[model samples]
Target: MIVKTKAIVFSAIKYSEADLIVCCFTQDVGIKTYLLRNILKSKKSNLKTSYFQPLTQLDIVATNKDKGTLEYIREAKVLLPYSSLHTNIVKSSLVLFLAEMLKNCLREEEPNPILYMFLEESLQWLDEHEGVGNFHIYFLLRLSHFIGFYPDASNMKHDYFNILEGNFQETKTSEYCLEGETVENFKHFFNISVDDISSIKLSKTSRANLLELLLTYFKLHVQGYQRPKSLSIINQLFV
Candidate 1:
């Protein structure tokens, strides 16, 4: 089937000397993997390696096949051209870390226009903004809303947040609970938007603690989700 849609590049791996296996989350077909044959060897090809960078948004014309077989892209062009997402150190780190997180969680092959729009617009916002030190934390928390595990903020006044239950409680439920300053910081995120993420100042230690809490929350809620390996690098950059 020939389909043209907007796609977010998740991860690309070289399949051979001349070909690349690119995994993308498409607005039309959800998650699709395309095999770009001879992309590396053909100098005349329009599909350059630059087009497949992590989280680079593109409009693609592609042919889809069976689930396990590789789909092929006839043409692709950058849909939202970013000026500094790949070059700026802070944004680039966030891009790498978020890309890994998305790769792990976005496994469905069904169209989710809401989720796709959220991702595309959020990334574009990140690209156009400055002082995004807290962007990833806000981004991950908001992502939970679309992924079916947004934390219940109705009991925000409670002392503990039960990670597994996705709600708050008067007391701790398990080892996967947040208390003290962590709960306080998590509460602030719910009251703000992506544009205001940086307005809430956080110390290095507090940022690290909140990040750990969010990742733990993801592990408890998201089935089959693994922690991103680039997390440590991202943490260091934030500090």
Candidate 2:
């Protein structure tokens, strides 16, 4: 079936010299990877290579077989052309890190409107906003909800957090427990808004440690999840 939908480019990989393998998360379909034949060399092709950049939002008309095989994109255009997401050094680095993350963690092949909109609106916000050094961290925290392991903060008064179990606890039951000021920083994001991100301040050390903890949580919950290789890039830029 041919369907037109909004998608976010996760990553584009070069294939067989000139062709490209583009994996995208569509708003209508969960995840669809397309084979772009000779897009690198065929300038006449309507699908420009730039549209496949990490986390680039697009409107795509694609063929979906739903058979666990690669599909093809007949036509695609930038749905929301970013003004600063690709140009600004900080935002671009975060984009790369976040893009690699989506590719690694997101794998459902069925439509999820809630997850789609969360990503769509958030990308637009990132492109338009300033002072988003912690945006990637916030993004990952929220992504856990869709991926099915959001922290259980109902008992936030607890002294520790069990990263593996994702619950607030009064005692450290095992090595996966997080305590002290780190617990406070992690809890600061429980039910906060993007606009409120700037309200909470963390030094560079706190930021790095908090990100590491989040990554650990994802690794425990998400099978086959790997930390993005571009993480070091954003780690340096966000500082």
Candidate 3:
């Protein structure tokens, strides 16, 4: 099947001296892995290695056999080419970390237009903006909505957020819950655009705590979702 859709580069691994295996989350079908033969060393190939960087958006024409075999792209062009996302140290770290998170959580072969929009637009916003201290946290929390485990915002009066139950609670149900000032700060994210994140301020320590809480929520919901190895890099860059 020929698929022409917008996709975000998830991760690309060098298969040999020249070939590359790229995992992309496409707007047409949820997730597709493409084998880019000789994209690295072959100067004759039109597809360049720069087009497959982490979280880079592209319009790709590809063949999806759907026979449990790896797909390959016939043509690809960069979409919404970023200015600072790849150049700035902080933004680059966030890109690497978020790319890892998306790679682990997104593993479907079905079309998801809503999730695709969120990713494409949010990353573009991050690239254009300056304040990004809360981006990763906001990104993951909002992402849970499309992935099946966002916190229930109806019960805001409750002091504790039960991670396992996916709701607010008057009392803590398990060790995997959010309480204290963290709960208060966390709730503010439930209904706000990424651009408004500047209004919600947190100390470096507080941000770290909330990030940890969010990760715990993910682990309980997403099977095989291990902590991203690039986490420390994000924490350090933001702090």
Candidate 4:
């Protein structure tokens, strides 16, 4: 089936010597992988490669066979040309880490329009903003809403955030739950936006502790979830 849609590049891998396997989350189809033949060898490859960069947004014309086979792209063009995401080292690392996180977390093929929209908007926000230290932390937490496990903020006044139950509680439910400083930091994230993310400050130790709490929350709710190997690198860059 020939289809045209906006897609967010998730990850790309070299196929053979000249081909590439590109995994994308399309606005229309949720997740799809395309096989680009001889793309690296072609004279026009520069444009194609640019579109496949981590988190690049593209308008793609492709064939969706829906036979559980790799799809093929007929043409592609950048839908949103980022000004700073690729050039800035800190922003680039954040994009790479988030891409890896999504590659692991978004495993389903079914279409999720809401999740797609959230990612589309979030990436644009990240690209346009400067000093987005808290972007990933907020992105992951907000994404849980679309993925069906947003932390229950109903009991916001509570002293503990129970990771397993996905809610705030008066008392700790498990060791995974955040308490003391960690809980306080998590609450602060909820009140931040991409623009205001930098102003929401945290010491390096507190940030690391909150990351641990967030990862534990993800593990409890997301099946087969694994920690991103790039996490430590991202943490170091932000710190």
TM-score (all chains, Cα) for each model: 0.97, 0.97, 0.97, 0.94
**Which runs in model 2 stand beyond 4 Å of their true positions?**
none
lDDT of 4 at 26: 91
Overall lDDT per candidate, in order of appearance: 0.91, 0.91, 0.91, 0.86
Native-referenced Cα lDDT, model 1: 0.91
lDDT, candidate 4, 1-239, per-residue tens: 89999999999999999999999999888789999999888986544677899999999989999999999989899999999999999999988999988987897688898888889889889888777877888999988888889887889899988888888889876785667988889998775666787888888788878877888888888888988988888878866
Instruction: Give lDDT for model 4.
Output: 0.86
**Model 1: per-residue lDDT, tens digit, 129-207?**
9998899999999999999999889988999988889898998768867789978888999978787788898998899
Better of 1 and 2 by lDDT: 1
lDDT of 2 by residue, 20-120 (tens): 99999999988989999999999799999999999999999999887888899999999899999999998888888899898899998889999999999
Show model 1 residue runs off by greater than 4 Å: none
List, residue by residue over 165-236, the lDDT tens digit for candidate 3. 989988877886778988888998888988899889999988998898899889999989989999999788
Give lDDT for model 2.
Answer: 0.91
Worst 10 residues of 2 by lDDT: 230-239
